[model samples]
Target: MRENRLWSFLYKLQDKQQKWLWLRSCYFGLKTTGPLLLLGILLQGLTLSFFQPHGFFYVIYRLDRQVWVPQANFIIHSLSCIVFGMTLLLLCTAVAWYRARLFSKKETIPSMVIALFLLFLFNFHTKRMPSARLGQVILNGNIPFIEVLFLGLVSAYFYHGLNKFLHFKSLWSIAGATVSLGIVLRGFKHLFNVGFFASLSGPLFAEISSLLGDDQTQLGTIIVREVGRNLLVWLGFVSPEQILVAHTDSDLSRANLSAALIKNNLEGLPHPLNIYSLSDSFAVLGGYGQIMALLLLFILFSRYRKRRRNAWQNFLPVFLNLNSSFLVGVPVFFNVILLIPFLIVPTVSILLAAGAIKLNLIPPAVYQVPLNTPTILNAFMGTNGNWDALLFTLIVLLVSMLLYYPFFKVTETTLYRIQKGTE
Candidate 1:
């Protein structure tokens, strides 16, 4: 009788837990409804403003000239965008609040008043003229674009949803979100777009980074750009000819390709960006952020026997610098503990090297490098047989090692614990 009663008690407890989990998931899902719809509208505006997808997230070539709707001025567009945004907020928030029981009558009235005030402000601003700031924001990226912010925020919320979904043991919604992200999200007939992660990863430290200007070499800029860059690639944002132009013209990748014809002369017409060696400075040991160092460390020192063993076996492939094994083994993407450091290390390393070049402490790399050349060698070759560039990469490599160490250590322990069920 006692054993039977015990089983009965446990069953009731499990049922209660299941209910609680689903209830919480529903609440969170409802809360996200407004933001998700707002994000969709913002995405539409960005696509309209900058680049258009050729049916279902196809090749995203640069626009020769931005297209505006027929007979629409910036003011008209801005007003329409604002009006549509308000409609979304009203529709989404009302449904969400009703479902989630998120607001009291007392709070709802004030919230409605605040929403009305925004409507008035947007209308007032419409008459005042849409400032050139809108265009400026897109060009120089001086301010956070809603497109980028939306991606980062949605990724975070997706993770939040995943946690709740897992707690509730809801296979249905989990499959739905994942499948939808890849296929139905953009309505692309293809099964997946590589840019799916854009809305699912990156930009957790946005506020911290924003305080630092969105400079090319700033951590704040790198995190958003790192994720945004991949998304752009997945969206096929750059054409081969455009990439060629950018490589030859961009201060980052441009080398004196004519160095051989010019008798290795690296002098150039005066330009602020043209002065520094960028291609190799940005390329660390194996990949961006010099993650290979961490992989090496893991192979060498990981206490988890199985992980270290796998790393040891894969050393040569990783050394040859194949990207696949280490990416999954270290599991760099979406690993929250490592994300901040992954974003910061490359920027810090580049800034350090850029400063050295600026101060004439090192020779600027001016040669075009082979794309697959190893980083340390690229450092040596790209700088016209200079050893200092190699040394600079080594120094930056060491610094990256330091930055990544503690995070890797913590992650290793957490993974081990999870594997062993010790926690």
Candidate 2:
């Protein structure tokens, strides 16, 4: 049976066209089904967050929740998945090909080295959180980290396959490699004793400082999500009316959107709101102008050592969803050139989502999803399992990537000029 199954897999790969289709299918499937599975998981989370607040089990369980469950919500998930997923797939394919092509390489080793060695050297020993709370400090016995272990293993394999273009025949080798990673990660310790390296912002700031001059530049101002947050608030999405009243055609429109009459005022408790669009969550794909995307772009695609080194140095912070380093580092704060898209992208994202909400095309994101949650998950959780919001967030992210592309290229040019003593 094993031999027969193996032969079938081999045969599928033997046909080049079939192989491409399979790969594309998997990518699309992930772009599509991954969210549906996450949506169902989100549904379960919505169910649980109400009952259990302080348990570690709920956290890990939801973190580890697979999308394979049989659930009634799958239908809802599937519909949104197909609609948004295909759209996202197209957008991503286009950007990656023309705009973001050769823009990023997921180099784990060099990045880790620069990030650890450099950030530690730069942080000045500013502690951010308790060792136990900071993670990486305590690698074992933290049940919440089970999610990390599995996620890391999966990511390691997925990226490995992508980077190496492994074939079906390499499945066993891949499995063996994954096991090896698990073993390695389990034994690894935070030997640098560098809490600040892990916690504090570093190298990206140097990159920004280099290009945009220094703190003396009036342009040294940083991006503060000034675009997305204020717009959503002005549009009444952030601050929804207490009661939603039905009215004439004009009033029934998306512009007249309102939230649930009751909000979770239980001191620290969070509840659903109907009026909040995904403005804040979708504002930045990976922080201001989705600059983390820019970091990855530079790291993988940049021809300059300055950019590549700084990008890798900041990659850890960016991946951790800490982007101020990149922002202040890039000095996107004051670079009028970069700042244009920095502000405009979020504004567009906010308006796009607000218009959608006004039209009742998608739901508002009222759930206070965990803060600093990355990308699509933010869309999912912030909307309280609303797939439309997740899809919309992705669309916003895609557009944001495009918006950032030209500016990124310009930044690269400026850096090149600086290198050549032309600027």
Candidate topping lDDT: 1
TM-score of 2: 0.37
lDDT of 2 by residue, 1-423 (tens): 995675454334333322343233223322332333233333333333222332123354563353443243354335433433333233223222221112235334322222222222222233557663332221111112112212322343343454457542344664465445444443342422444444455576566444433111111121223453323322212200011111111221222223322442111122121122333455556544556657767776788886577677666545434443344344443244555566677666766765676676665554444333454455465445777777777777677777777667656665565568643
> Residue 296: error of model 1 in Å?
1.9
Determine which window of 10 residues in candidate 2 has minimal summed lDDT. Answer: 239-248
How far residue 83's Cα lies from its native spot in candidate 2, in Å, is 46
Candidate 1, which segments miss by more than 4 Å at Cα?
Answer: 1-255, 258-276, 419-423
Put down candidate 1 lDDT per residue, 46-111, tens digits, no spaces.
Answer: 333333332111122333344652334345445434444443344323432332233233333323
Q: Report how far off residue 371 is in candidate 2 (Å).
A: 3.7
lDDT of each: 0.44, 0.41
Tell me how candidate 1 scores on lDDT.
0.44
Model 1 lowest lDDT segment of ten: 136-145
